[model samples]
Target: MILHDFLPSGNGYKIRLLCACLGLNVTLKEYDITKGETHTESFLAINPNGKIPVLELDNGQCLSESNAILLYLTEQNHLTQQHQSALLPADPILKARVYQWLFWEQYSHEPNIASPRFWLTHNAMTDLKKRMLPDRIQQGHVALKLMDDTLAQHTFLVGDAMTLADICLFPYTHVAEEGGAYQLSEYPNIQRWIKQIEALDWFIPITQG
Candidate 1:
């Protein structure tokens, strides 16, 4: 399989992290979104949306979207069962909760947190980024505080062990301060949760050295 992605992106990192945990040997095809590589005709043919972490399977089929790629990768492993446990739950009610947070990460969390980090901490500045500062920080803190509250009660997003929701959310939240938290200094639960994820052998930070 071939995985097309931008290395520093959390969305991309999620796919990579999952593949690593599952022991999938997918070939890496790096793209520079900042350089508009995904907009090219060649890439669009694979995914008209031109998104990163597009997975080209051995059978010549393609899977786009980070979460979708993650689900696909885990489908056949013992981790497959663990996958549903950690990422997708078997119970309809529990699964709904997992989906809720995953959706939140994409819509509420990523936009406010990831976008700002891509603009600020990574030193990729633009006028739009300059304009987004106050709003981004405000919304990001809201998301962080919400996460802190939830995590104060649960060890992971779903059951007692790690799940898809935690993996999905980690990339952006782990670097909240970089985007604009100034200091999520009081969210002790979040800090503790970050340490837990970091302790995992499969954990890989989006920005690698």
Candidate 2:
């Protein structure tokens, strides 16, 4: 498998992190999204949406969208006896909870947190983004608070065991302060959760491929 990705991207990092946890060997195809690399004709052929983190399987089929790839990897891992813990639980209720976090991350978390981080850190800010920043930051706090409150009740997002939900949210949430949009200090539970994830043996930094 090959991961078409940009190293700095949390979305790309999501797939990379999961592959590390699953002990999967996937070739990394780096792209400098800063240079419009993902928009090139060849990259476009892989994902018409022009996004990074497209996972190309051994048979040449490609999967786009980060959370979808996470689910795919976990499902594939479930079929083998290699990984001990299940990232996506078999219980219907628990699986639904995992799905909930994945959807919420895209809709409520990423747009507010990830977008502002990108705009500020990458020098991509504009007049419209400047106007949008305040509101995004506010909503980001709301999203973080929700995660914090939920995490305050359990070790991980869904329950005691770590699930796909934690992996999905960790990338952006851990580095949210980069663009001056958030302070992890304000969310103590989240801080603790971040530490717990980092201490895992297979954990990989976002900077890692």
Candidate 3:
């Protein structure tokens, strides 16, 4: 498998981290989004959306979208009575709960946290973007509160074990303060959860070159 990705991206990092945890090997093809490499004709052919973290299989099939790729790569790791997987649950209800968090992360969390972080890091905080910060911060806080409250009572999002839900939410939430507009210190449970993820065996650190 070949992974076309931007190293600094949380969405891309999710895949890298999962691969590390699962001991999966994939050849990585890095792209510098700042140079408009993702928008090139060839990349667009692989992913019409022109996004990073496009996974091309040995058969030439391609999969895009970070969460979707996570599901695909970890399919074999899904829960089974004989083999309980920490990455995915076997019970239907538990699986649904994982999906729920994944959806929420995309709709409520990523937009509020990840989008702002990207813009703040890549583009100067001009008057227009500055005006949008307050609302973005509020939405991010709301998402953080939800995660904090849930994590306070449970070790993981859906069940006693870590699942895809944590992977989906971790990338953006961990670095949410990078833009300097938000501070994660407000959510103690979240901070604890981040530490737990970091301590996992075979965990991969997200880095930029």
Question: For all the candidates, what are their Cα RMSDs to the real structure?
Answer: 2.4, 1.3, 2.1
Measure candidate 2: CA RMSD.
1.3
Per model, state how many residue pairs clash: 3, 0, 0
Instruction: Write model 3 residue lDDT over 78-134, tens digit each, in one string.
Output: 444432455777678888998899889889998899888988998856787788989
Error of 2 at 209 (Å): 0.9
lDDT minimum window of 10 residues, candidate 1? 77-86
* Candidate-wise lDDT, in order: 0.79, 0.94, 0.86
Choose the strongest candidate by TM-score.
2
What TM-score, over all chains together, does every model reach?
0.88, 0.97, 0.93
lDDT of 2 by residue, 31-148 (tens): 9998999999999999999999899999999999999999989898763244455789888999999999999999999999999999999999999999999999999999999999
- Candidate 1: residue 192 Cα off by (Å): 0.9
Worst ten in a row by lDDT for model 2? 77-86
Q: What lDDT is obtained when candidate 1 is compared to the true structure? A: 0.79
